[model samples]
Target: MRILMAGVSGFLGTRLVDLLVADGHQVTRLVRRPPRGPHERQWTPSAAQLDPALVAEADAVVNLAGAGVGDRRWTDQYKQLIRSSRVDATSTLAITIAGLSEADRPEVLLNASAIGWYGNTGDRVVEEDAPPGEGFLADVARVWEAATRPAEDAGVRVVRLRTGLPLHRDGGLLKPQLLPFKLGIAGRLGSGRQWIPWISMSDWLRAVMFLLARADLSGPVNLVGPAPVTNAEFTRELARQLRRPAIIPIPGLALKAVLGGFAQEALTSTRVLPGVLNRAAFSFRLPDLPTALHAALHD
Candidate 1:
C-alpha cells in the first residue's frame, strides 16, 4: 500500500514509518519545509494547502499532526497552537481528499484523535459511541475529529484514532516518569484514582495497521489496551517494575501550578474501552499493564 503520512518526524510517526516500510508499504512524508527527497512532499497546513495529486497517489493517508499538548507549559497562546495545529492540518488533508476524483481518491484516511475526547470520565468507561465530554481537550478533540468530515463526506473510509497514553521508554508518557520513579521519589498524582487509558507503542502501531486493513471499520476507534488502570495502580506497577518504592505523592495543586492548563487534563480520569477494536478482533501485543511496562522498559 502507498501511504502518505504527516507527522513522520514525531516519535510515534518515526516508528510507524519504519514499520510500514518493513511491511513493504511505500510511505511518503508530508513536510512543512521544501521537499528534501522523492519520498517527501511539501504541505502548508496553516495555509490549508495540500496538492490533490498527492492525495490521489496514496492508497491511504495517516495524519498524526498536532502540537504536543504536554510538550510545554500550557499558556493561552500554546493552547491555541495546540488546537490550530491539529484542526488546520486535518482540515487541509480532508478538504484535499474530498476534492480528488472518485477514481483517484485514497481508500482510507486515519486521523489522530485522543481519549481526551471523553474529558474527565472519572470512573465511567467510554466506548466509541460515547458523546463528547466537557473541558478544553475534549473541545479540541471534537473539532479535531470534525475536521475530517470532508473526507468522510467524499466516501473515504475515515477512522479517527482516539489514542491513549502510548508507553515507551524513550519518549511519551513514560519518559518523564522514568527518572523520578527510578530515583524512588515518584508517587501517584492527586488522589491517584483517576483512570488512565494506556497502550504500548507496539500495540499502537499494530492497531493502526489493523484499522488500515479493515475496510469494514470506520469512524472513531479507541486505540488503547483492554485493561484500564487507575493512576495509583499504574504508579505502583511502574515502581514495582523498576524495583523502586514510590511513596511521594504530588498534590493536584502542585501539578496545576507546574503544568498549568495541562494539569486538569493530567488529573482527568478516563476509563476508555476499545469496543471497535475488540469487535473487530484486533489482537493486542501488550494487553496487560505489567506486560506493557516490561516491554516498554526492557524490549
Candidate 2:
C-alpha cells in the first residue's frame, strides 16, 4: 500500500514508518521544511498549503501531526500551540482530501487522536463510543477529532486513533521513568489509584496497520491493552522489573510544580477500553501490563 503520512519524526510516527517500510508499504512523509529525500514532500500545514496530487496519489493518509503535549510547560501560549498544531495539520489533510474527486481521493484517512478525550473518567470504563469529557485535553481532543469532518463528509473512511500510553524504553511514557526506576527512587503519583490505559509499542504499531487494512472499521478506535492497570500497579510492576524498590511516592503538588498544566493530565484516570478493536477481534501481542513493561524495557 502507498501511505502518505505527516509527523514522521515523532515518537510513534518514526517507529510506524519503520514498521510500514519493513512490511513493504510505500510511505511518503509530509514535511514542513524542504524535502530532504524522495520519500518526503514539503507542505506548510499552518497555511493549509499542500499539493492535492500528493493526497490523490496515495492509497491512504495517516496523520500523526501534533505538538508534544508534555514537551514543555503548558503556559497559555503553549496551550494554544498544542491546539493549533493538531487542528492545522488535520484540517489541512481533511480539507485537501475533501477537495479531491471521489476517484482521486484516498480510500482511508487514519488520523491521530488521544484517550484524553475521556478525561478524568475516574473508575468509569470508557470505550470509543464514550462522549467527550471535561478538561483542556478533552476540549483539544474534541476539536482535533472534529477537524476530520471534512474528509468524513467526503465519504472517505476515517479512523480517529484515540491512543493510550504506549510503553517503550526509547520514548513514550516509559523512557523518563527508567532512570529513576534503575536508581530505586521512582514511585507512583498522587494516591496511585488512577487507572492507566497502556499498550506495548509493538501492539501500537501493529494496531495501526490492523486498522489501516480493516475496511469495515472507522471512527474512534482505542489503541490500548485489554487489561488496564492503576498507577500503583504500574509503579510496582515497573520497579519489580528493574529489581528496585518503589516506595517514595511523588506528591501531586510536586508534579504540578514540575509539569505545569500537564500534571493534571498525568494524574487523570482514564480507564480506556479498546471496544472497536475487541469487536474486530484484533489480537494484542502483549495484553497485560507486566508483559508489556518487560517488552518495553527489554525489547
Instruction: Provide C-alpha RMSD values for all models, in order.
Output: 0.7, 0.7
State each model's CA lDDT, in order. Answer: 0.95, 0.96
- What tens-digit string does per-residue lDDT give for candidate 2 at 1-299? 99999989999999999999999999999999999999999999999999999999999999999999888999999999999999999999999999999999999999999999999999999898899999999999999999999999999999999999999998889888988888988899999999999999999999999999999999999999999999999999999889999999999999999999999999999999999999999999999998998899888
Error of 2 at 292 (Å): 0.7
| Model 2: lDDT of residue 269 | 96
* TM-scores vs. true structure, each candidate: 0.99, 0.99
Off by over 4 Å in 1: none
Compose the digit string of candidate 1's lDDT tens values, residues 110-201.
99999999998888888999999999999999999999999999999999999999999988889999999988889999999999999999
What TM-score would you give candidate 1 relative to the actual structure?
Answer: 0.99
Error of 2 at 235 (Å): 0.0
After superposition, the stretches of candidate 2 with alpha carbons farther than 4 Å from their true spots are none
